[model samples]
Target: MIDKFVPSVATALAGVKDGATILVGGFGAVGQPDLLIEGLIEQGAGDLTVVANNAGYGRVGLARLLAAGRVRRLVCSYPRIPGSVIFEDLYRAGRLELELVPQGTLAERLRAAGAGIPAFFTPTGAGTRLVDGKETRRIGTRDYVLEHALHGDVALIEAWQADRWGNLTYRGSSRNFNPVMATAAELTIAQVYHAAPLGALDPEAIVTPGIYVDRIVHHPAGALHA
Candidate 1:
C-alpha cells in the first residue's frame, strides 16, 4: 500500500531538520497552510530558509513563524505590507535575511526546479540591482539575466481534498503556489480538508498527483485562521 496519511500534524512534519529550505505555498493568506505552520512552530525546527510569495500578514501563518524566530532567511516578492510588522522589525534589526525576487521570477525558479531545468534566462531583472552579481546577457534587443532553479527540502501546502495515496486538490484561490511548491520540494507535506477514499476524487480534478507528495494531514477548512 502507498498510503501517506499521518494521524497528526507532527507526524506529517517529522524529519524536518534545522537549516532546511522550506517552500511555503500560498498567496498571502488565501492558500496558506496555517495549521501546519502552527504545528511547525511546536515542532521547533530553526534556521529555515522560506520561499514564499510574501513575508506574511498580521500575526498568523508565516508571520507567526517569523515571530517565533525559526526562519533564518526569507525569499519572496514582497517582504513588507501593511500588517507585516514582524518581518519589518526583524529585517530592520538585521536579525533576518531577505532575498527579494520578482513575483514572476520566483514562480519560474520553483517551476524550473521541478521541471529539472538547471537555469534559465529572464528579462525581468536585467540592468537592475536584482541582477547585481548575477550573469546577464542580451539576446536580440532585450537583456536577460541568468536565474537558477529554486528547490526546497520541504514543502508545506494546503489541499482541499486528498486520499490515503496523497493525491490532492485545491479550493478556489487557495490553489496558488501549492501545486508548484509540491513539485519543487524533496518532501511535500499536504494539509488536506477532506480525506477521501481511493478513487473518490474525479481523476481529472486532481491537481497534484500522489507521487510528488510524501505526507498528508487532514485539517478541515474551518479549523484555524481567519
Candidate 2:
C-alpha cells in the first residue's frame, strides 16, 4: 500500500496535528523543503514549535511560516537581521519565542538524538550566555556544558533524489541537516524533485535510508529559489 510515492506536500503532512514539535531540516536557504512548508502553511497547522538553523529568508522559506503565524516558537542558532519582516514584527510585538543554540551544538544534539543518545556534553559555550541556567560539570578542571538531544514528531526535509521506498540523496548544503533530522523525527517527510524506484539509487549514494523516511513527496518542478 505504501508503494506509490505521494505527490504533494500537503498529502505528506496530512497526519501532523497542531502543536506538534517539528525538526525542520535546513541551513538557511539551501536545505529547506519548500513544498512542504508551503503545504503546511496552506493546511494552517498552528501552534507549532519548529527547530531549524535559520527562520528562512524573506518569503521563500521558513519566513513564510512566520508570516502565516503558524509557528509559535522557534529554536535556532542564528540572529535575524533588523527590519526583516518576520524578525521586526516578532521583535516589536515580543510575540516570538526563541531559544538560541550554539550552531555546532544544535547540530550535534539532533545527531545524538537520532543515534539514540539522550544527552551529551560540549564546551562550546562553557561560560557564555548560551549556557545560562544549563547544568554544568567539571571534568579535570575544565567545565563542560550539557546539551540534550532534540527529537520531533515530524521532520520536513528536501532531498535531491529519492526512491519509492524513501532512500534519499541530498544536493549541496541540503545534505547538512536532512540526514540527521530524518532519523530524529518519528515521521519524516521528504520533498524531492525526482523519485526513482526503490534500489535504483546506488547504495553508496543513499545519504538517508528509506527506513527513516515515512513519506516521499514528489515535486518534479517548481521555483525552488525566488
**Number of the top TM-score candidate:** 1
lDDT for model 1, on a 0 to 1 scale? 0.93
Q: Write the per-residue lDDT of candidate 1 for residues 1-226, one digit (tens) a residue.
A: 8889888898888999999999999999988988889989999999999999999989999999999999999999988888999999999999999999999999999999999999999999898898899999989999999999999999999999999998998989999899999999999999988999999999999999999999998887677621
Q: Which segments of candidate 1 are over 4 A away from where they belong?
A: 224-226
| Candidate 2 TM-score, C-alpha based | 0.93
Deviation of model 1 at 24, angstroms: 0.5
What shift in Å separates residue 73 of candidate 2 from its native position after superposition?
A: 0.8
Q: Write candidate 2's Cα lDDT for 1-226 as tens digits.
A: 4553775566788978899998888877777887788888887789999999877777766888888888888888874743246755774697778889988998999999899999998888999987999999998879999899999999999899988778899887779888989999999988888878766898998899888999887877675421
Q: After superposition, how far is residue 202 of candidate 1 from its true place, in Å?
A: 1.2
TM-score to true structure, per model: 0.97, 0.93
Please list the Cα RMSD from the true structure of every candidate, rounded to 1 decimal place: 1.6, 2.2
Q: After superposing candidate 2 on the true structure, give the runs of residues whose Cα lies further than 4 Å from its correct spot.
A: 1-4, 81-84, 223-226
